[model samples]
Target: MGEAAENLNYDCNYNMFLAKIMLSNLSRPEDRQKAVKWMKKLATCNRSIEEMKLRNDFMYYLVVNIQQGELQPPFTDNPPTSPLPNIANLLPGGIAEVETNEMGEPSSTQQTKKPMLYENSPDGGAFLAAQPVPRCGAFCYLAVVAREPKHD
Candidate 1:
């Protein structure tokens, strides 16, 4: 029993040592490729995912505009509100409805439907998990981290 315990300890130490070496060698092309492939496999096509990405991009644009002081706040008779223009009406699918006041001022009320992409998929996360990241652009190297192993 004592000898068996020592062997198990040695094996555990060896595996840990190997893992440390692997982590240290993460900058190697092979290691990077392995990580990239896994990432690509996990990150590929899905409508809800695409919508989320687009929403994040739009949010980034909004943040940039705000930081640059390009965004304007709405004027009010007694107080002030966000100067950002009402752009929900410009989106597609007729999913959003906007209402304006008699003074032609946006009231900041909109009825938005859940995006169809999100509604159709009950297990969107699992669906995304099962997809393979597409390689379509010069930066597809970034997506390689999400790809499934392709044996030839």
Candidate 2:
């Protein structure tokens, strides 16, 4: 693969393939390190937009794979309590009051709105009582609905 890549005059695709092989789990640590160096070189030596894009993609994969252990998520297992307002506080009549603009519209900064709730009963149980089993089954109803022409 390295010979083929070299013979191809450092073709982006062939070089990227070689780098992928080197970075694979079965490859030796030295080979993986060499792949990282080669990738960094390719990423910085792009002569065209297409090559730049391909190199950028490979670089992204290399960084994600090689530096995965160093990259910590924004949150931890026992993350500190978020300072942001709670969902309940964002609801209507909650502790936090939404500010309004001069036009009486909710301000852009405080745009929380009451969520739409759908329920067939006050207790919010099943949408409807079970009916007699259809002759064609539930899927037939879906097929029929799908076949209907759009009114618009």
Give the top-scoring candidate (lDDT). Answer: 2
Error of 1 at 17 (Å): 38
Q: Give residue 151's error in model 2 in angstroms.
A: 30
Off by over 4 Å in 2: 1-28, 69-152
Model 2: per-residue lDDT, tens digit, 34-144?
555545565454554544544544444444544342211211112123222232343345444656688866677964443333243443433333435542226221212
In model 2, residue pairs whose N, Cα or C atoms come closer than 3 Å (at least 3 residues apart or on different chains), thus clashing, are none
Model 2 has an lDDT value of 0.43
TM-score of 1: 0.18
lDDT of 2 at 112: 49
Model 1 agreement with the true structure over 34-113: per-residue lDDT tens digits: 43332232223123433334333333333333334332221101111222223343333222444667776656575545
Q: Could you estimate the TM-score for every candidate?
A: 0.18, 0.24
